[model samples]
Target: MHEVDMTKCLLISLNEWRDRREDTSAMVETVHLDVGRFTCVEPDQLVTTYNAAVQGTWLDGSRLTITEIPFVGRCLICNGTYDPVPENAYRSPCCDNPLEEIVSGRELRIRSIDYRSDAAAALESAPIQRQR
Candidate 1:
């Protein structure tokens, strides 16, 4: 699956980003990603791939949070925006013109990352739970 390749790329990018950071020893806790509906990247599959790939690595146990972005198309002729569903023929609803501009969607990028500088900080930030 292409998700494997995507995961590999993600790892490489994450590593590069970590290397550039001042606290290279920081442990990533979560990665927030924005995935567009039109990008054709299955969030479930990507998450599964990422989980498997990160096992036994520095990123192990890190959570991946995906926010799905809806497909919004803008009509150049009418300057109207619409969501291109199957019933809409992927055209502009205002003028029945072919979608010319994509207002959103088709995005796949890392939005943010949550990390702890050290194990002690991570433990201190953990929620306290009462015993039953």
Candidate 2:
């Protein structure tokens, strides 16, 4: 599954972030991600894969919080927006034009990371990092 690769990339990013910081004892608590419905990334499978992949690592027990972005497309001819579904063939309902411009729903990025530092005794948030 692609989720395995995604998890690997995520771990690499998290490790890179950890390496840059001074607090090596900080443990990742959660990872916030924004996934588009059109991206076809299964949230459940991704979570399961991530949990399995993080086992025995610094990110063990960390959770992934996914926010699903709704699919929105714009009509090329009519300039109207609509939520595309399979029933409509993902085309514009107003002018029967192809959905050429995507207003949203193709996103797949990391919003932020939350961690708990043992030295600080408080939760800390990492800067937002978008995945390419």
Candidate 3:
């Protein structure tokens, strides 16, 4: 089975860490996730795999929290929120109004990363550290 690379996800998590521009040996304990309704994530599977992948890394021992965001479309005619569910052999289901639009079904964001990093302390302990 072709799979979404967990390593890619690990990189994304680390990128979140680096973007904070922090430097430390501190630990990360939790990762907040925002998985879209139609994002194709099997929550149970993802959590299990992600937890295993996070081991032996900076994110080791971290827990992944998956938040389910709804899949909704805004109808342009009446500004209505529509949740799409197609049954049987589908042709294409319309909202009966031309204004329906998908908004939240494809979200990809890392809500937050719980970590501790101390740049100043790291600098102070550096070998041949620079002084201003």
Candidate 4:
């Protein structure tokens, strides 16, 4: 399911960050994910999967923050943009027309990462050098 893919994505991101910093000792505090309404991924399930996948890894004990993007659409008939309510049969509120273009609600990506960079801390503690 999507959980597998989501877990993979998170691992890939963590790996890339480690590679860039060349430090695997840093602890990740939180991972921010931007998910759209149409991605159909349940927040709770995603968290569980991520936690399980990150066990025994550097990302273990890290928190996950999910930001949901609402389902938005554009009505071709009235040229109106609005949030489609599933209870209302996904119709445009302004013109009562079917949504023609999906303006949003299909996104699933990493928004940002919060981590304590070990390299930065080491650099800060190191003595500064001046050149003449």
* Cα TM-score per model: 0.85, 0.86, 0.69, 0.81
In candidate 2, which residue ranges exceed 4 Å CA deviation? 122-132
Candidate 1: tens digits of C-alpha lDDT, residues 79-116: 88899876877888777898778889999899999987
Tell me the alpha-carbon RMSD of every candidate. 6.4, 9.0, 5.9, 2.5
Give me candidate 3's TM-score against the actual structure.
0.69
lDDT-wise, the better of 1 and 4 is: 1
- Cα displacement (Å) at residue 123, model 3: 14
- lDDT: worst 10-residue window of model 2: 119-128
Question: Candidate 4, residue 91: CA error in Å?
Answer: 2.7
Return the top candidate by lDDT.
Answer: 1
Error of 3 at 80 (Å): 1.1
Model 3 bad stretches (over 4 Å): 1-3, 88-100, 118-132
Cα lDDT tens digits for candidate 2, 1-132: 778888888888899999999989889999999989898888889999999999999898899999999999988787778999888889898888877898999888889998988867633344567799
Best-performing candidate as measured by TM-score: 2
lDDT of 4: 0.86
In model 2, the Cα lDDT at residue 126 comes to 46
Error of 1 at 98 (Å): 0.5
Q: Compare candidates 1 and 2 on lDDT and give the better one.
A: 1
